[model samples]
Target: MRKALAEVGQTYDVVVLGAGAGGMSATVFAALEGMRVLLVERTEYLGGTTAFSAATTWIPLTRHSRAIGADDSREKVSGFLDRAVGNRSPKVLREAFLAAGPEVVETLENKTDVHFRPRPFHPDYLYELEGATSFGRALEPTPFEAGELGADLALIRPPIPEFTILGGMMIDRDDIGHLMKMGKSLKSAVYSARLIGRYYLGKMRHGRDPRLLMGNALIGRMLLTAKKLGVDILTETETTAFVTDKNGVTGVTLRQKGIDKRITVTGGVVLASGGFSRHPKMRTEKLPHPAPEFSPSAPGHTGALHDLAFAAGAHHGTTSAQPCFWAPVSHRRRPDGSMAVFPHFVFDRSKPGIISVGRDGRRFVNESTSYHQFVSAMYATNKDGSHVPTYLIADAKALKTYGMGMIRPGGANIKPYLADGYLTEGATLDELARKLGIDANGLKDSVSRMNAYAKTGVDADFARGTTVYEKANGDPTHGPNPTLGALETAPYYAVKLWPGDIGSAMGLVGDENTRLLREDGSVIEGLYACGNDLQSIMGGVYPGPGITVGPAIVFGAIAARHAAQRAAAARRGEAGQGEAA
Candidate 1:
């Protein structure tokens, strides 16, 4: 139903679709190799799901680890991958990812504005897994100032507003310690003052402060590096279909501003559209019933590249038992009629005095496990969606100390939350149960049992505070048990949680070279995929923090290098023909 309004005959050495971490990384790498590159994005702003992320990259046995005094080896990481990813993982792909990951980081940091540091205390999601380490495998981007981006700052998508403070001020894990005690301690007060002062100063210069951190920082640096390397970036351009010859894919037909145009590519096309998380048809086919309502992914993500690749004869990869990486999300509808969905990762769950319960008013999970593990329990217990609205119950003291969902710590006013219907409050356990439509007697008995556990600093029912992973997420200062506390306060509170997915698990089939493959296992020359578009190397299991972005960056590098070499070879062949002529 659309018409071609124009055609672009310019042949780029490499054309990258989507501007997420993967696509951006590929563009930067290819440009660094002197390839005539073109980067296109469906959205006006760049940085797909990655911008809203914590921006941690889980890369094992890297130079960063070595610098941090970690003694990890490739063999150990491989053993861990084998045990964690199981038979569903491709051995060659896994090996390639691990091998290329450290190199990618080294090159990026050595050549461009991209920078990272080891998270010395960060642990794998399943720390107890074979060969898993307690630290040094994860790396986070160095925080970047928005002013360094200049005019391009507006084009970098900011972190989720729900993750920010006082409107748009972004803070990282290090800022939490100071913020939690800002009012009580002088040093914390000075730290908070300095942060606020910097934020306001930036606001005075730019309409919004450009003090980018986390995922935004990673993408901001990538964009700047790409620009410096002379990569042409086209925003609001949709790649509708691939232009293929008998030999292989040669270019792409793009629809931009409602006008279709064809752009030739001599190098290759990289598919990194942040997966099919938002596509209705794909959601129907790949996800469970009652499609997920909230995703931390960029709004532009709708699996367009996947559809286009499939139309071009690319085969679907083997599906995972788990089609998506899961997380529990809690939302509050704002006065502007927009809902703010917050993914509960490391903040509130493992904190003392909080428990998650189902419709039957009983604890269904440990409530201190990894987000993926917690959501898995949610699915197993609430089959058929009977527990449409699960509640996270906590007492007044807990709410004041730890906060719930979007509520910040340090005694934030809860009256507004209650008035907006975001929180259910009751003076007593019975009152709260009645309001939440749960069995009052069952909730009472559950609370009594949890209180007993709190007294002894032990969770006999679901082992809430047993694992090192749980304790790591907990408040170490809390006495008795850092993650266990009695709910014996007068006022109790509850917030509803819904199952949400952070990334897709299934995608186009690809080989160790990041080349897309056909049904017969033949490679599609000049076509590559990475990020969520390539079936995750870990299959369905979430091995550790930054797994998604870590492999995304590595394959992005792989795809770019391979395409650049191929294009150079083709150019040489053409030059040879000219000499013969």
Candidate 2:
């Protein structure tokens, strides 16, 4: 299966593998510094897992945050991280992230087309913790027009199909709010009309409205800048082996659309190949049971880069307390007989009159908690190791107001979901318990307790709506406790839940410069890793929105800058020798 090349395919100052947020950022930053860069991606499309994400970046103390009057002081953020990560936190890595993160955002925004808007009131996930602010830290990409990519439009991965409406009209956070209130208010009706009108016009001219938003928009902006700077992008190419001699990572051997090719590089290699979310072996070894079969990430997350790096003598990090970042996901079989998974990030769990229960029909954790905390509680409570599914229970009124999983609000076509076994319905508590094979008595008691809490506006058992984080997810317009309302309506429903990981927290141990380290604490000559491949600075704790993407952008830039600097120094050395000759 192996073939040796008669001659190397090409040479470049830097060769960046993978085209997700990390790799794209690295490519742009490296190219910005005048480095001849070759960016390769395994899939035909760029963006990778990040394209399917919400595209929020949690960059604290950013200029936008400061402008918006955020109190993102160094002491404050550090206190929050200390509580979240504790002893596992790497001080230097955290310091580097805090120092370089804002600059990276500034560079992309100022020098490139990559633009971001501040989420001034976005609360940190653990708002209950000390030093957590009620607002100002997270930044999101502004919507981008896909037409700017031209023929390369097809090369970008689209967002999850569930997030779109009307066969490819991608909606953002603001659009969702407007669409939810459409026809009920005049303002919402006008906003919805304007959004749909533009989508139709875009579709009429282009096969698909290339109006990219969220993660897709973020990647698109980076790709546009890379193209303008003449960065060479090789899609459908995978790095199979790293070529080395006296120095580490001299180049890489790649299989490009099936043909074997070897490319030499003088600068260095940057590995930002997303994460190993889809790798079965890695999942079994690292992640807990009920490992997700339906990830929103790209299918090429096979952990190939991890294997390659490990073989090259890279050591992994010790932040295994929380190995993977998790979210609860609901699944349904599409018309094509494929499973469509939709992550319940902010949609159903935190709404009033909803509670997540285990097989025994007992509420396990605070339903309004962060996705990471919710799933962690699920793992901790599944004591017997049985493969029973966790269920999100809601009544007809709650279902209509806030749809469960793939089911949209306003009671949209539940007949098909029930027929497909994706949703379970019960006219009463006992019937629902029997249908789900849960304890009927336990289910009745749970309902009674919920009704009591709803009436009294207090959840003594789990304190669901007590924190700012929980209230943020709740319907603020609702009564006493926005997250706690009586589930007393008839025809109750439930959707099975599974633990889904966005990316791995445990990764290769690397330094602030993004250089991979050996177990003995020495750096691997020229090998570098960033993104989800590098150990999370938060030490596996999901502190807030965009924590994952923020570090990915920062470390990717750090790796690129380091490689470019080395290449420049080497070039100058060669030039001096030639002049002496």
Candidate 3:
């Protein structure tokens, strides 16, 4: 009835899609099991979101954080995530995510070169929010050198424009700001410099290497590790169709540089090609920005592979997705597509971090919420047809002391946004109100109340002064009552900000095992998805650091592990039915 083994030398245990952390993580474990693994990524680079725009990988509310003096648990973590989607996250997936998170992080640490250190100072978005712990759950990847990547390193995108990796070095979070600080102990200063210098030397030798010492560092390093472990990486390729037989998946039709090719395999297909963030057509019809210009996410997050999977008939949960998280560039864009930071002198003086307001010039929600929520709020508002331009309001002291109102002008120098009306400024509460084109009387009163709270360090309407860190990050020396001073300080600054998103958080649904599924609730044999490409386990909400990459690694590994098991069975005369929970 069936053809015997063809021995075409083309089949293997697993084929991981999207060489980014999500896909790579799955491949790593699968390959570790001694199975032949083939990995495919549409982008020239690997590490998906982690490579292009990952700030941190979140693994909060874990047992480690609690054992280390911070208090938290799965119940609290589940509370936040479930509240976001009203329990839409399937119980199996939720339990699997919680159960496997720590194990996944632990595996990366002991098995491969991926290193993670706890960031204790990084607090939860809402410090007092239930189950919110100050540390433990936030593990930042150590820096790495790009030289280890050898030839493949050049293909991956650097974390951002300024942040580059070279050789095998990896940079961690703790060392970032310390690199610039001046008052460290003599020994500490000398040690930090030597460490940084060593990394620089490595990068120098491996020109254009990634800084594998930090968040992006580990992501890049591990990808190279997976490749070294016999993972076949076919770049610039697309899985156009899922070749199937009576039992399940049989192979895939792939395209490269517009040429069609087919690869028949007995193992499964893991779809980690990422979300629809960069799709020009999807951007126009969905996303808030409505612009086809560059999104920081790596290219090929077009949801094309997703469409193909759906056509093949798979059961999935929610398909509507967006980069549930990300931030707007505070300044403006550089020619190389990076953001320019407004002088710190400005932020230190005044600027309550601008608010991306709707048509009304009022506080919508906590602007300080994680960047993910900011974009989500923006998306939600836009979906309802609300035209909102962000407004950044700051006092004149905010102006003279800091480059308070400035964004990248794509010009030679950073220009004050206020000068070009990209930002609006004025003196006096009423005048400032008039400049913003809002009800001058309403704005004046708003200023009056905001000032009163600033005086007493207590915001009555919005409790802006509640968080000590918020104020600490603000002007601590702003005189008699810091935070208040009546904004009465001559000249005010207000700039408009758009809702910038990191990437969408919806795509092919997967189970706790991270098995890729169809819209109708059937698992597409061998298919798996994670990161922004899978429906967010957090329901498009960011609960903590590494929120994007953390799950990616967890589920990616999960997907690969099962694929390996299935592959081994097919090699034998046994019926290759995958084991399930």
Q: What is the per-residue lDDT of model 2 for residues 1-581, given as tens digits with 9 covering 90 to 100?
A: 01123322388888888888889889999999999888888887888888998778888888898888987798899778888888675888988988898889899989999999987578999988998987778889999987877777777887788888998899987898899888899999999999999999988877776889999999989989998998888877778899977547788998865688788787889988877666779888777776666665677667898888887778678765688888888888789887788888988998998888887788988999998888788888887742236889999999999899998888788999999889999999889989988888877788889989988879999998998888989999997999998888999999998877888788889888999887888777668888888888888788899888889998999999999988888899989999999
Q: Give the local distance difference test score of model 3.
A: 0.60
lDDT of 1 by residue, 48-143 (tens): 989999889998887889998886899989999888888776889999998888889999999999999987688887777778887779999999
lDDT of 2 at 93: 90
Question: What is residue 11's positional error in candidate 1, in angstroms?
Answer: 0.9
lDDT of candidate model 1 versus the reference: 0.85
Which is superior by lDDT, 2 or 3? 2
Q: Backbone clash tally for model 1?
A: 1
Model 3 off-target regions past 4 Å? 1-9, 60-67, 83-85, 126-129, 162-176, 183-203, 284-294, 319-323, 329-333, 336-360, 379-387, 396-445, 465-491, 574-581
Instruction: Score candidate 2 by TM-score against the native.
Output: 0.96
Expressed as tens digits, the lDDT of each residue in 325-360 for candidate 3 is 555434555556755432121132223423234445
Q: How many clashes would you count in candidate 2?
A: 2
In model 1, how large is the Cα lDDT of residue 528? Answer: 97
Identify the candidate with maximal lDDT: 1
